[model samples]
Target: MVIAIGFEGSANKLGIGIIKDGEVLSNCRTTYITPPGAGFLPKETALHHRENVLAVLKDAINESKIDVKDIDVVCYTKGPGMGAPLATVAVVARTVAQLWNKPLLGVNHCIGHIEMGRIITGAKNPTILYVSGGNTQVIAFCRKRYRIVGETIDIAVGNCLDRFARILKLSNAPSPGYNIEQLAKKGKKCVTLPYCVKGMDVSFSGILTYMEERAATLLKEGYTEEDLCFSLQEHVFAMLVETSERALAHCNSTEMMIVGGVGCNERLQEMMEIMCQERGATLFATDERYCIDNGLMIAHAGAEMYKSGIRMKWEDCTILQRYRTDAVEATWRKD
Candidate 1:
């Protein structure tokens, strides 16, 4: 009976989870965005985590109705995130583990997402479409390792969404990503945006600039905002779909799984599902609990590692700003 606690502050979201064996006992998450309602701000992010990490952790434990003394292990995200925020989580988890005399395991944020996706989709060797404000990639497992087949050269898909949402003044009144999706629904016309595809690498900054210029021109002519949103979603989603399909073809993997923040988009999931179906590929997603950045993913992953007697040394797990997904070695015991 291995009970584990997981803390995550790797992104704009704060998550805490308690796990018993391989099942989640309780999972909690709270979101805090940046100042001026823009993208994630490191200073503000650190401050937010420092302020609320403890409350969220305690609340999660209470809500889960779990006893702290039963905890045998503790896990915390160590890197691949805002340094300030990740540090905040590490400090908290370290303190808690120290207090309880529990051994702490430092988890990789990207691998956390991938492991959660595996749990959600149950796709043993699926081709991965991972996109977020921080990462955009086409990945697959090979030779006991995750390989990055393709990715964006500049600007992740979610960052493009957030920036465009700011450009349209959609940050305050409603959620930026959700608002942009709504606007895209109202858009009736399509506008041609720059498509930069270099082998497997795609660049969204150039497309973003073109769309911004075109949007300004349209606004000058009183063009509808809905149409602009629609065109943008169409073009961006098409590019993603094209690259995903190409990766699938290259890998010859017919199973597709999406992970990351943007993976929450119903529209994106629908598009990927349709693409996967076209090629007779099966697609699966999280069952709410593992969908967003929740501590459950980390705890669940840690529980798996703990069961196998795998652990990370505190001195070895460094915060990585430009860490690639393929860099981490896989520990899954293939039966």
Candidate 2:
């Protein structure tokens, strides 16, 4: 029985979570939202995290009804994110660990998403489709790590969507991607767009470039924004589904899991469900609670590693901007 507190501020969102054993007790977060046609800057995102993390942590603790002293371990995302935001969370985590006299665990942001997906959906040994603003990969447990079977060659899916939203000056209230998903629902026309998939990998930069040109031309030509949104989602999601199917075929696995910010798209899920149905396989997914970046995942994954005796000192909490998913040794999974 272990109680753990986890902090996550790897990107635009700042989150705090508490976990007891393998179950999530509370998850609280605040996203740093930029205005339309804008993207979040590292420094600004870091400042947002610094301002809101403590309050989020307090809320998490209060919601969980757990004393700070009862927490056995402190965990925070250590890598594969913006340096400023990562450092912001690390400082808070280290400070809390020292103040509470608890051991510290540094967790990989990508692994946090994967582990939380597995725990919430109970999909063992499934092929992973990790699509986010910074990352896009198809992963599976190989030997002692999550091996990347397929991935993006350029920008990620979520990055493409965000940039497109900026081009159209779309609102960033909830999220650019979510807004696009809603616009896509009102589309009936399917305009042609580039779908680039090389081997088992996918690329979104070319698609984004083409979509930008089309968006400008079509908007001038009295084409609806909804049509462009629909076309973009259809083509890109098809590419992703195709790549995932190929990975599943190569691995001969009957289960597939999607984890990341873009995983919240209903069209992506619908396309993936069709793919799974055709292959007679099961699809596993969680709602945005576990799909999007959150401290709950950090807590759950770090707690697992900590229970396995993994610990890190304050001096060793270095953060990486491009930590690969396959780099970490998967100590928790036997397969």
Task: Pick the TM-score winner.
Answer: 2
Highest-scoring model, lDDT: 2
For candidate 1, lDDT tens digit of each residue in 1-335? 88888898887889999878667688898888543446767888878888988889888899879789888889888667788888778888888988998888877777888888887677888888888777888888887667899999999887888888777767633346667888887777777778788888788998889876677788777668788777777777788888989999998887998888778777788899999989999987764457667898788777777887887676754456656677766776452
Per-candidate Cα lDDT values, in order, are 0.80, 0.91
Error of 1 at 211 (Å): 2.5
Model 1 gets an lDDT of: 0.80
lDDT per residue for candidate 2 within 189-296, as digits (tens), equals 888888899999898999898877777888887779898889899998999999999999999999999999999899999999999999999999878888889999
Model 2 RMSD in Å is 0.9
User: What is the lDDT, from 0 to 100, of the residue 311 in candidate 2?
Assistant: 76
TM-score of each: 0.93, 0.98
Candidate 2: regions farther than 4 A off: none
Question: Model 2 lDDT vs. the true structure?
Answer: 0.91
Error of 1 at 187 (Å): 1.7
